[model samples]
Each structure stands twice: as structure tokens, then as C-alpha cells.
Target: MWRRVTSLSHLLSSPKSSPQLTPTSYGPKIWETLSTEVSKKSGGGIFSKERSPFITFVLGGPGSGKGTQCSRIVETYGFTHLSAGDLLRKEITMNSENGAMILDTIAKGKIVPSEVTIKLIRKAIESAENDKFLIDGFPRTEENRIAYERIIGAEPNIVLFFDCPEEVMVKRVLSRNEGRVDDNIDTVKERLKAFRSLNLPVINHYSNKGVLYKIDGTGTEDEIFERVRAVFDAWK
Candidate 1:
């Protein structure tokens, strides 16, 4: 998924787990205040001196286990897990005006606009009480990346790319049974095409910045996470 980037159509599974729901050390009151503060502030507003959270961007093909590994990471490292796909799905569920548009976009295996995805992420960050975050399956395009930096006034501290083969990714997605809008064969193929044309440049950008950690994602979940844990260990 990460290396050759020839195809990534299979990584588009429904995100079944969310680390964002995990409990935080901060109380509800703290979260309430934090949410208020974040809501009032626009992206790139003032407070340039304010430090953002420790963010780790997890990138992979649709079936590369980004969601599964994020759950493990949250348990082990106490980072809030925020899946961009989940956030977009939530917007759909809430019947937001943008919901239909988002659904159509995903159904076609095209990326939702950066503004929409970034807004959801910014809200999640503002509401979160944790200082560390594992933002999964996001910044899918260079526009997405630049929008995040411009609006959030922060860049990810680390980027983890799951390097699974296209064949492996395709098999996993085919068997995922996630009931996702984009899980069909045709959509998956388009998503793979989008991954190469849209997402790879973002990955290359992060790699050049020296914060990208490429992990072999061909093994069982536990085995892959062992590698993931080692990366975190080294970071610590």
C-alpha cells in the first residue's frame, strides 16, 4: 500500500472501531471548556503560540488494517483515535446538509473536499481532552494536507504508512463485509486509482519531512502492531 502505490483500492473498508470514544484523563468539564475554546477559534485564527496535540497520521490502503491497529495504539499509548472516514460517516448519520454530497463522493471513490474533512477533524480535536492523537486515513490528498496545516496551524509529529501489497489489500477488502458504500468491486478499483493519483504525493511529502515510518503490513494484526509499537518506542 505504501511503497509501490500502484494500487490501493482495497483499503476502503468501513471503520468499525474509533479511538475517539475512549475515555480520557480529563473530565467532562475540561472537555466542555476545550470544546468551547476550539469552537470559537477559526483555523489559523490567533493563538499561534498555542501548541497543538501530538498527532500521528496513519496512512494505508483501504484494507491495510489502519482502523484495527488504531484501536491497539489507543489502548497501549493513550492516544485518541480519530478516523477521518468515521467522522465523515458521522456527518452522514447526523443528516447534515453535506451528508448526501459526502455519500456520493465516497460512492464514486472520490475524495470529499478538504474543507469538509478538515472541519470535522478540527472539531474532534477541539472536543478531545487528550494531547496525543492517532488520526487515521486522512489527508488523502495534498490539498487535504495543506488545508490541515493552514487551518489547524499544526503538522503531524509522525506519519505511519502501512506497506501492504495490492493483492493482500484487495483480498482483505473483498472479505471485509463492512457494508460500506465504497466496498463494491468497481468503487474499490476507483479508490485504488485515487490513492495513487491523490494520496501518494501526500505520503511522499511526509517522507521527505523525515517523520514517516513505513511498516510492513502483510502479517497478522498482532505482528503488525509489534512493529508499530517498536516505532513508538523509538519515538519515546
Candidate 2:
């Protein structure tokens, strides 16, 4: 995991202070507690316009290799890749009260509550020093999209959809061997179904907004990333 050293906690500790991008090892539970305490003390939300980051939301099915390509993009383009799934998994490891629920949700291939997932992403954004971000596996539902916009008060500058076939995605997931809770065949099917029923609309929303760049996610990682590179290059 790429991490930046920041002093955001010190800033948030003060009731009237605005958040300054700072890295902290505090878990999501601590961050949420701090945020709620701060909100009550300050009588306002934690977000501010000064914290607006140039975000790219990466959308894809169960096994579209978004994670793999995101690493390459981070290396090549200097963007922070914040994987929502990874964040949730970390919460489980931290023995959070929501851990069992998140584990069950992932095993069933259902989306975690939007608020829970967004809080993790929000903390990541606040702590990172980089302005460019690739937010992976987020906004999996319409509610997720709405909650993120309402809470974060910003939209993604670009949305990258890895358009891959269902069969291809299944194969990739089966072969992934990543020890993820949702990597089994049954879970993959459920995830694909969720992607179609829930995630597709989010993609379409971005498509209509004209910030969506659909990449043919069928070839080698390098080949697919070439197409991805072209899209980001044009954006630059």
C-alpha cells in the first residue's frame, strides 16, 4: 500500500480547524469517531473545497484487473490508487464491529453500506498528499454514487470502465487465487449479477456525463493499459 506521511489528525483535533492533507495510521473506526466528534464540536461537516482532489473512479466487473492496471497507472501517472474493497478488507482485519457484516456482504457478493465504504475512501483522500487519485471498486450502486457526491461534494474528473466479457471475468476471478472472501464461483456470479443490475447504471451515468472512457479489457494487461494510457493522455 502506498502511504504518505501527513499531520491531518492534529488539524482535525482542533475544533475550528480545516482538514489539512496528512497521513495517519489511525483505522477507519478512529477516523469515524474523530469525524463525528469534530462535526459536533465544529457544527459542520468535515469536507472542504480546499481538499478537493482530482479523482478518477475506476469501474469494472468482478475480475476486470482494475487492481493490476491501477498499480501501473499509479507508477506511470503519479496518482494514488485507493481500492474500496481493499479498504473494507482492512476494516475486517482490524476487528471492527462492522467486520462480520462486511465479510458476510462480500461473501454474498452484495455491496457494503455506502456510508461505510465512503468513509474509508474519504479518510484516504484526506490523508494523501497527491491531488490525483484513482478510486477503485466504488459507487457500486446508485445509492453509493449519491452518497459519495453528497458527502464528498465532488464528482470524479474521469470514470474508467473496464469493459470485459462475463466469461473472461469469471476466468480471471477463478484464477486470481488472492484469498479474497469473494473469489469463489458462486460469489463471482453474484458479483457479476450485482454489476449488471447495480453497477451498470453508474457507468451509464458517467457515460452520459461524457467523462467516461471505456477500455476494451480483453487483451494482455499491457495491451489494455495502452488503451488506458491513451485515454489518460488525452485527459492530460
Candidate 3:
């Protein structure tokens, strides 16, 4: 198992001392109340000292090959792969209660509520038997980052940010033909805008925390995975 090196000081600190999260007009009181109830029922968090998992938050803009790299990591390192996007999409497919909300949010290239996304993620992690996990395309905003930390009661062991150029990412997405609703030019542009405005801060936050590994996201799939392999291998 990978060792946890991040200090508990921040994880255990009072909310006031934590980094100030971006304010949103979403119903914060309702979310916090629900999150607290869920956390309490889940034994203070999805993880405990005895069952803490090795988590790697895989971050990148759309078509940055984060999903591709996550698959390779899971195959090579025995870590379970969980894509937040995939989970939300699954909810849409199942026509769950949040299906309409998630679909509309995704279609507009807006983020789903942290409360909803975090619940799905927590459920996925709890159901998996693996002690190592690669959570791809997550913590897309500072709100996401904070909500996760508050509800999960732990920090990722490491974070991987795939740095790819926007032009390259757009070309790759357009040609990949994934049939995703947000793969077209307009949505891709919106997603990129969202990435810059929201995701970059989360990336910088991890970098500041000293647990982020940035990998070159150019070139062939094999080439990119090679760079990713070096990071995971070192962790091993």
C-alpha cells in the first residue's frame, strides 16, 4: 500500500482555519446539514484509520487523457478506477432522482452539486474492495475540493495533473468520437473555460500542498502513460 505523507494538521483543523472556499449561491445550509447527517451515519467518514485507502485524484481538462491514463494505472498497479463523470452519467442512465439535474448541469458544462457528486463518489469508494484508487476528473472546483475533504475526512495521497494544450485537447476530443453529450465544439469550449476558471485553482492548491505531480499530456497514448508510469512507480 502507498504511504500517506500529507499532514493531518490541515485535515483535522477547524473549518475557519481551512482555505476559504469560493462562495456559491447553491443552498449551502441544506447541503451542509445533509452532509453532516451522512457523515455521522457513515462513521464520521467513508474511511477510517483501519481502512484508509490510497487515493490519487487524477485531474486534467477534458480530452487531456486523464481517463486513458487512469485505466492504465488501474491495470498496471491494481488500483480501482472511479471516474466522477462516469458516475454522474450512470445516474442519468439509471434515471435516478438527480438524473434531470445532473443531465442539465452536464449539458451546460456546469458542475453538478458537490453534495450529489460527493455522495456518489463516497458510495463508489465504500463499495470497492481495493485499498488503492484512482479518482479521475474530480474535485473540478475549490468547492469540490473542500466538500470532499469535509465529507471524506481525508486527503488524497497524491494528485496527478495532466498538462495538455487546449488545441491538442480539443483536437483529441473532436476526433475521439466518444458520443459524449459535451464533446462538441461549443461544449468543449465551455468546458475549457470552466477548467481555467475553476479547476486550475484546485490544481494550484494541490501543488501548494506538495502532493501534485504534473505530467506532460502531449504525444501518443503510450508516451503519456510512460510519464504517468514513472510517477506511480516512484510511489510504489
> Who wins the TM-score comparison?
3
Question: Which candidate number maximizes lDDT?
Answer: 3
Off by over 4 Å in 3: 4-44
Candidate 2 or 3, higher TM-score? Answer: 3
- Candidate 2 backbone clash number: 2
Better of 1 and 2 by lDDT: 2
Off by over 4 Å in 1: 1-51
Off by over 4 Å in 2: 1-49
- Candidate lDDT scores, in order, read 0.75, 0.76, 0.79
lDDT digits (tens) for residues 1-236 of candidate 2 = 22222312221123222222323454536534533443443343334323335678999998888999999999998999999999999999998989999988888888899999999998887788886899999989989999988887666767877878899999999997988888999989999998989997797787677566677788799988887776665444
TM-score of 1: 0.79
Give the TM-score (vs. native) of candidate 3: 0.83
lDDT agreement of model 1 with the native: 0.75
Residue pairs in clash, model 1: 1-164, 9-192, 10-63, 11-61, 11-62, 11-63, 12-62
